[model samples]
Each structure stands twice: as structure tokens, then as C-alpha cells.
Target: MKKLYYVVIGLFAFAFIAYLFIKKEPLPTYNVDRYYIEGKENEILAKFLLAKDSSVIELDEGHFLLGQSLILDGVNNVTIRGKGIHKTVLSFKGQNKGAEGIRISNAQNITLENLTVEDAKGDNIKVMDTKGIIIRNVQSSWVGKVSEKNGAYAFYPVLCENVTIDGCISIGASDAGIYVGQSQEVTISNNTVFYNVAGIESENSTNVKIFGNEVYENTGGILVFDLPGLTRYGKNIEVFNNKIYNNNIKNYAPEGSIVGQTPSGTGALVLATENVHFHDNVFTNNKTTSIALSSYLLIYEMGKRDAEEEKSPDELGNGVASADKLNDEFLKDKKYNPYNRKIKIGVNSYSNSRWFPTLNNDFGKLLLFKKPFQTIDILWDGVVSPNTDYTICIDNTKDINFYNADLLNDFKNATTNESLYKCR
Candidate 1:
């Protein structure tokens, strides 16, 4: 009798499981309304001019010419997407007053995707003072050959946080193609940047990871920079898996610009930053040094001698107010450090570079005096404090040339200290 009761209970459990497995799933709900707009210029501008929170603006595939910049400011959770990158185009060919093709500011959770922007009066796409923003599958360009008159930055995001820019193309910016300044927690990956002064630039930003990108045919491929008078220092940055080659494009940046200080054919330039890691990257055919390391004093003495602080009072509160003040109060203040230290270069492949450093300025002449046969794969201006030996490690770099120009003492005596830069 007990065995018979157990068999009945097992049958009942199996039947209940079978009933649960046959239940149906609910269909997806489409409650949010999508507002699609196309055609005549004024009507399209009207819709975007007054964008509200949680707004979704879809632009159809076509050529759009606007006289003014399209702005989506002070909005949250807004999505401005196009049908396709190649299908939809926004042109600022006739723009005379606008500063960008699209400018987004003071927002959160903003997503901009699948659009092509060209011929802007200034930057193609710029986002500032925002958080939780995503810029994906976008193409930004200036319509003609690379020129100084072109915009300074293509995809410019400044003072932002938690931003990710992926699958984008930037071309023909006189400054940096993709410039991220004074931001943090950023990821820039899978982008193609070409024909610009600097392909990708990170200035005074922290916790950035740049990888899986193709950067070529620019003056300098990648620049990790820190200028004075900007809020916060740049640290904890990682750059890997990038194809940086043939960055011999002529320097088209206007005179006195920060990028103009960059030598043509530089693969990567790290200036006045700390804790940067470069790993598993390809560097080839660059006419200059494949990798360059220097302090902010190198370029700061070049030409940007304007004593007048560029940042306003509000912006000063955000970043360092003055370069002089930071230097004066160096030890007392932990917020600013203008020295490039603790850089790790690991497992990178470099070939056919350092051909241009021989022709560079006074420092280049000193490098040529050291070794005339081999081009310098890595060039470090040996500018450091005696008390604190900044750690720069280069590990497992095979068959690559290197130079250390001790510029602090007028480049009189230099050292090939291979033992000092061992992998840590």
C-alpha cells in the first residue's frame, strides 16, 4: 500500500511540471510613441529645437542642409538616431553662425547613433557636461581635403562621464579627430580616424580605455595630453589593440594650437600624464618615432605663452585655474601633477618608423648624434625630478629602436639606460 501511494505522488508532480512548461509567454508591449520627421528644413528644426526629456527623434534617410546648429540641450534620456549612417546625412555646408552640426549639453542618458555629419562650421558633433551618453555608428567629416580652416575636432566630448563612443569614423579635423577632454570613465573603441592632425586625443581625462581602432594617415596618430589650466589630471588610461600606421599627414592645425606642437608621423605621444598602459598594438610605417614620451614643459615652452587664463570663473572651478598656481603649489596640492610617469608599454609590434625624428628640431639633432643608422622607435625626453624617478617600462619590444634625449640639461649628455625601463 505504501509503494502504491509513492507512485501516485510522483505521477502528480510530473503532471504539474508538464502543465507549467506549456504556458505561453506574453508579447512585447510597444507603449512608447516614435516621432518620425522628414522633409522641409524649418519643420524638422522645430521638432528638435524644443526636445523634451524621454524624447525619441528619428530622422529619415536623406540629405539635410541646416544653416544653424541642431542642439539638444538640457534633456534627459533623449535618443537622436538616424535610419542608417550611409542613408541619412546632415550637412552644415551653408552654416555661418553655428559652431557644430549637433551640440548636446547638460543631459543624461543621451544616445546618438547611426548618423553622418559633414561640413560643419566648427566641430561636427560635440557633447559636453553630460553623463551616461552613448555615441555609436556615427561618421563625422569635413567635406574637402584636410585643411587648417576645417573644424578643430570631429567628435568632441568634454567634461563628460560614463561615456562610450564606438563604431565611429572621424576625418579631416585640424586638431584631434576624436577629442575627449576633462572627462572620466570613458571608453573609445572600434573607431576609424584618418586625415587629421591627431587621430585620437585624450586631454586631462581619467579612467579611459581606447582600443580596437584603426588610426592612420594623420599627423600624429594618438595623443595623450595634459595641459595647464584644465581641471584634474589624467591617469589610469589604457590603450591597446590599435593599428597606428603611416601617420605622416602634414600638420594643418593653425599656428599656436596645442596639436601644432605635435611632430608629424608620431604614433603615440604621452605628455604630462601618469599610469598609462600601451599593450598589444601595431605601430608601423610612421615616419617619426612610434612612441614618444614627454612632459608638459616640452610643449608649454614652445609657443602657447598666453598668460591670460582661458577658462572662465565657472570653468576654473571645474579644473585648475592657472598653470602657474599649480606649479607653485605642486607638493601641497594632490589634485594636479604635470609629470608623465609610470607608463607601461607591453607586447607592442613596431616596424619602419623613426624616420622623421632625425629631421626634428634641436632635440632631433641630439638624437641623430647618438645613432644615425636606426630610426628611433621610442623617444623619451628625459625630463624628470631627481627625487622621484618616474617609472616608464617597456617590455618585450623586439627589434625596435629607442632613444632617450636628456633635454633637461640641454641635451648635452644622454643615456641608453635599457636596464632602467625593465618590465615591472
Candidate 2:
């Protein structure tokens, strides 16, 4: 019995030493000399409200439940950071005032990093009319069931210049996870976006680069769009070196929204944009189409046809005439261009597991009617300006199939001719 007791004591000592050796060291505490905010929710709110120019506000490592939006307006050189992305969380789950969880307007040289913001009533983080912004190592999400009631955008920078969004994760946005609109000189890199209507979208932006991101499981992976009514038209955009796959999520955007018209299983979409380049991207498991190049006229005409069919099944053929009249009306504004021009697709890889396309929206149904047996790798609407030469160039993509839907002629001369789309 004495020998057994001694052996048991030895075993316990050995186990304790092993545990000590293998245990992880505690994370280093944030010790920078700055304005640190902690304690109750109201205290944090008061500190945020007191922030001024050149303020460095450091959030402590705790979850904060705030009632109103945090606004940083007309400040210069402001930095709002936290202990870590997972350690510091700001939730506006019950936000009653303001549309955005965190709103930065008319600011210059702002930086937001190392935090998580979730469940805002509108946009999680909205930066508008600001210049020189950096959003790094941030995470934004909407928890619970994914629905139209979720916010439209996670990280939204609109009408801003010199913006960079890097190393971020965004999820469950009804419209877009990361959206840069009407901005200039933007870089969005190394982000992970999923479960949104659009994973990443650049609308009416110029000199934009989207690279080094993993985008999957959204309704559409990446979109470069120039809408009709926007003052700015997108140009000089490059999308390269990204992994976009499995973007087959159902469309959850609210009715009448532009993104609500996006079909599921879209890997990349270029719509009414000029001088856009896509290269060195890997696309896999996108069920409907890998890359779709569309004109605003085609999308509008199809939507009109769908609506007409819903209202009066006998009025199917009148959509094209109505769409032409609307396009003419939109052309009254000289800045608006309805055709996609100078789109260069270079050296991208694509693989799909499913052969059949999605039939959830009108675009997908059109694809089904065009090709019943197989899915498309690349699709172009074949809508071009009658006065200008608009080209869709494809290089180093001989293995992937291409289709021209001939929307101008109403699919009377749809073709799979690769020679017509060779790079000029």
C-alpha cells in the first residue's frame, strides 16, 4: 500500500509538470499611451463622443452593447483601435437611433482596426465623403437567420478617395459584404467575405484594385458595376490573384434593390464598366457561370420582361421596345454609358462541379433556355454601342467555353464563336 501511494503521487506530479509545459502563454495586454475606454456602455459612448482631431481611441478588451451610432464627423487624423479582433466586440443589436453602427463622414486620414462590429440596423460601418482611410484586421457580421432584414453592407466606403480595406472578414450582408462606391484609388485586399448577396462590389469607382481575397458562398462573388443614375462611372479597375468559389448562396437582397437582380452561382460579374481587367484568379464550383459580362440594357430588358410576364402573360415581346425607350431617356445624361467597354479577361482558372445552372432568377432561367444541358464558363450579352467600338477580350482561356447571347438581336444569332472575342 505504501509503494502504491508513492507511485500515485509521482504520477500526479508528472501530469502537473506536463500541463505547465504545454499550456499557452497569455496574450500580451494593450499598453499604448492613448485614450482608453472601458467600463459600462454609456461610459464608452461618452468617450467616443468626446473624440477630437488627432485622437487615438483605444477600446478595451470587452463586449460593448451600444444604443446609438458612433459618429466621427469632420475630424482629421483619428484612429479607433481595439485590443484584438476577437477580444473587442461592438454590438448594436438593439440600435434605435441612426442608420449606421459606426459612421465616419467628411473625415480625413482615419484608421479603424482590430475589432468586430455586428448586428447593426443598417450598414455596420459606413464611411462617406472621407479621404485617406484604412480599415484593417476588422470583422463585421450579422448573426441569426440570414434575411432581407439584415444590413445592406458590412464595410461601406462611398464617395471617398484613397481607401484601403485589408485583412477583414464580412458576412451575412443583404447586399454586399465589402462595397466601395463612387470612390477613387481604392485597394481591397486579403479579405474573406461570404453569405452576402455580393461578396465584394465596386460601383462607379475608378482606379480600384481587388486582390488576394477569398470570396465564396455569396449570391455573387465579385462585381464591377456602373449603374445608370450614378454620377461617377467605373473605370481602370483590376481584379486579380483571388480565390472565388462556390458562390451559390440564394439571393437575399430586398425587392427593387439593384443587387436583388443578381442570379445565384455567379463568380464574377462586369456590368456597364469600362477598362476593367480580370487576371490570375481561381474560380471553382460556381454552379451557374464563372464570368458574366452584361450591359445595363440586357439586365433591364430581362427584368422588364419578367415583370410583364408576371402581370400579363400575353405581353412578353414588348419588353425590348420599352427598354429601348428607357435607354434613350437615360442617354440624356452624357456621363452615363450603358455598354461595357474594354473588358480584358486574362489568364484565369475556372472549375465547376455542377453541370446544370441555377434557375432562381430571370438571368439563370435565360441561361437554362439558352443551354439546357451544360453550364457556361463565360457569357457576354453582346450589347455594344452602335457609335463606339466596345470589345470583350479573352486571353489564355482557350479551355473555357464562351457564349454570346446576342441580346441586341434578341438571341436571334447567339453564337459560341471564340474567334470573335480574341484579344485585340
Tens digit of per-residue lDDT, candidate 2, span 213-308: 999989899999887666677899999999999898777786546677678889999998899999999999887898999988776776566565
lDDT by residue (tens digit), candidate 1, 39-121? 55675677688789999988877777777889888999999999877677887877977789899999999999998888798
Q: Give per-model CA RMSD.
A: 22.2, 15.1
Worst 10 residues of 2 by lDDT: 27-36
Instruction: Tell me model 1's lDDT, rounded to 2 decimals.
Output: 0.77
Whole-model alpha-carbon lDDT for candidate 2: 0.83
Q: Would you estimate the TM-scores of all the predictions? A: 0.82, 0.85
Candidate 1 Cα RMSD (Å): 22.2
After superposing candidate 2, which stretches have Cα over 4 Å from the reference? Answer: 1-39, 306-332, 387-389
